[model samples]
Target chain A: MTPLRIVTQLLEIAAALIAAPAFLGWVNQCRAWLQNRRAPSVLQPYYGLRKLFGKDVILAENASALFRFAPYAVFGTMVAAAAIIPSMGTGLPLSTAADAIALVGLLATARVFVSLAAMDVGTAFGTLGARREMMVGFLAEPALLMVLFVAAMISHTTSLPLIAEGLTTRALALYPSLAFTAVAFTLVLLAENARIPVDNPATHLELTMIHEAMLLEYSGRHLAMMEWAAALKLFNYACIGFALFIPWGTGTEAGGPAALMLAAPLLALKLAVAGAGLAVVETLSAKLRVFRAPEFLATAFLLAVLGLLVYLLLGA
Target chain B: MAPLSFDLQLLNGCAALLLLLSFSMLSQRRIVNLVNLLALQGALLCAATLLVAVRTGQGHLYLSAVLTLALKVVGLPLLLHRLIRRLNVYWDAEPVINASGTMLIGLLIVVFAFGLAQPISALASTATRSTLGIAIAVILLAFLTMITRRKAMSQVVAFLSMENGLFFGAMSATYGMPMVVELGVALDVLVAMLVLGVFFFQIREQFDSLDLHHLESLKETE
Candidate 1:
């Protein structure tokens, strides 16, 4: 691997690792502001993580080895996801493995591990949460793939970095297909990240909770790892969205690692804007009933497929 | 290439927005929101027509765009809102099919429209010919909305949306029809809306409800 490529890859992963929690905190702070509550510090997640990490582990009575292993597996997979997304540069050594299908597979792997761990505890809420999470996963995955397919179709390759690079270098033009896919991708992002109108990330009420219900059995560092992984997943998804839609700042390969360095502030700016938009969406809409989650995701899927059709029809 | 003397990308963006507005109207249950979506559709149609007019140097299309803004966007929606107020049909009852099923059918109709428009799009020479499939899809989806909806006001909105799709189809395929024909069609649509508005009152008076289901009882028994 070229030294610059390797450095850019590591830089991207490390930045995502550090910024993920901050991104979550930003969204939470924005939500609090929009709801007219006193806003928390944007560093609130880091404070919570520090507190959680310093505590001792406490596990369920019948916790299996799998329960102990899932948190690390999930965290590792999200980091791996972050590594491949080309947020800082389009010429990473890991770009070979950054195929859109492979990226989807990595995400699915993390979801599987988390769901399996949730069911391992055997609590009623745990199993219920696992079921709901799986339902969302299956429904959202196809839409996610369809979103990527439209991008891939345009770039004539399934590789994420290549798509971003292709779009960056091409002359400016509007792809109606991209417009349609963007709406679909936003819907998928909201659902996959347990955001509003699908599942409320803030809800802890037993009957209504989906993501939180799964983590009720974990405590201490394990819980911290799981929460960190959740944040990283959101960060990674946001980066993917950036890579697909607003890929301008990442720069073409001829610009080199200097361009990668230049991308950092732009990435931060995008995260800030996207996080605020997410908060606005969550504030404006109520969570759908659990039964309606399928319909919500179904609409996302249809919109993504509509993007593909638009691409085909317009040949754009 | 001097950028073709017009923004083709802007035209495509407008076409995409028109399709999205169509989908929003299809899924909307509130009569008021459906009327608003129809007006939004008209605005996008006007924008697309203006783009084509600029590209082709056809002065008639500009007149058509202004007509669209005045009639479809302003007049029809205002008329529909008054009908909704007078008829007092605010919320549509449960559609004949659920939202998810309706979306699935709409998706199929879109695919079929693309397939059907393929040969025609190839033969057409206009800058917006590629949007022909979307125009046809809009028409069919509007038709689908009419079939699945239960309220008279919603059906009227869907009918106007269908007219929008037809107008879009004509624009994409031929840069627009002859001005006389376009004006004649606009008058026809305005007259049709008025007649439909009167029928809304007659139906409400006869059946005491705006739900088309009320008229079903009057169907000749087998």
Candidate 2:
């Protein structure tokens, strides 16, 4: 790999690490605004992370090494995912080794480690949360794969950067198949990220908690890493959506550094719009009953399959 | 050629949407909502017919489109609404198969329809021939809806939707039927609605319910 490509890859990872929590903060702020409440500062997630990192670490008496190691593994997986996803430019050296399927595998790896650690704590809430997390993961994963498959079929490549490049260079016309898959992708994103209409991230009620219950045992810097990794996962998902569907602003081979520079602002603008749209959707839709989650994911899976069929039948 | 291809694309999109709506109708349980879906399907069929008429410049197809708009879109739905309001039937009881299972069967029916239409579509010359499978799927789905539904009102709506699918199939295959046949079908549908509307009131008076299962009890059993 050239020095510039390596530099671009490193820049992409660093941007993901720094900007992800702010993206969360932006969504939270937008949600507050839509709910007619005073909004929190856009840097609130950063401040929350800083405070957690500075606090003392607390370990449970029965905590195993897996509990201590899970945070790092999850954090590493998110970073790896960030590196592979072409958020700013499509010329990343790391992305060459990983395709869209591999990217999904990375996220699933993080999920598995976190859920295992949650089970290892031997707490009732921990195990309950772990079970619910696995349920959500099991249902969401197929829909996620189906969405990626639709994009892969359209581009005729499984690679993330190449999919972005392929979609970007196509003539500007609406693809009905893409429209179906886009709705499916949005549903999967909401479910996978513990967003509203799936699980409410802000809720700490033991009866309703899916993600927070698993983290109830964590404290201090470990918690900080876990929170940061969650933010990075959300950011990675958003980037994947952009790479597949709205890939216009991303830098291509001939454009080089100039295009890369332009891509940064474009990425920011896209994220801002996406975050706001997410907040609005969350504000409008009520959380589904936990048992209803299967139906929701099944609808998403069916819609993604419909998109594929539209392509095959209509050749659209 | 460019404009013709663009129109073909639009027609294909409308066909895909019609199939999706058919699936939605098969899974829908509310009697009122099923009537609304029937109206929507009629509107889409009318739109598709108009597009095909414009592309093929078939004057008879234009008249058929107008007839579809008048009878299917506006007139039938209005009559169904009035009948349901008078009969006071609003929701369908649970079907023999669940919603998801019905949808799965609908998907299978679509694949089957595609396989069945393959030879026919290959032989067809219309630009919208690819949608022939979708039309067949829509018809089969409407039949499925009719079999699963308990309420007579829902069955009537499904029956109307089936007519819609047949009309779409004919339009895609050969532009349209002869004007006399089209007029006969329209008259037949209107008469069927009137006769079914009177039959509903008679059944309701006899059994004090609109569920078709009530009529099954009228059979002579050992």
Q: Which residue segments of model 2 deviate by more than 4 Å?
A: B1-4, B219-222
lDDT, candidate 1, at A195: 92
Segments of candidate 1 deviating more than 4 angstroms: B1-6, B218-222
Candidate with best DockQ: 1
Residue-by-residue lDDT tens digits, candidate 1, B1-222: 222223777877777778778888989999899999999999989988888888889999999999999999999899888878877889999999999889988999999999999999999988788889989999999999999998888998999999999999999999899999999999999999999888988988887888898887856463
Scored by CA lDDT, what does every candidate get? Answer: 0.90, 0.89
> Could you estimate the TM-score for every candidate?
0.96, 0.95
lDDT of 1 by residue, A191-296 (tens): 8898989888887775978899899998899999999999999999999999999999995568886787789999999999999999999999998999999998
Question: What is the Cα-based lDDT of residue A235 in candidate 1?
Answer: 97
Q: Candidate 2 on A1-316: residue-level lDDT in tens?
A: 7776877898899999999999999999999999999999999999999999999999999999999999999999999999989899888888878899998899899999999999997999999988999999998898899889988987899999999998898766557778788888999999999999989999886587889989999999999999999999899999999998899999886688899999999999999999999999999999999988887887787778777777777677
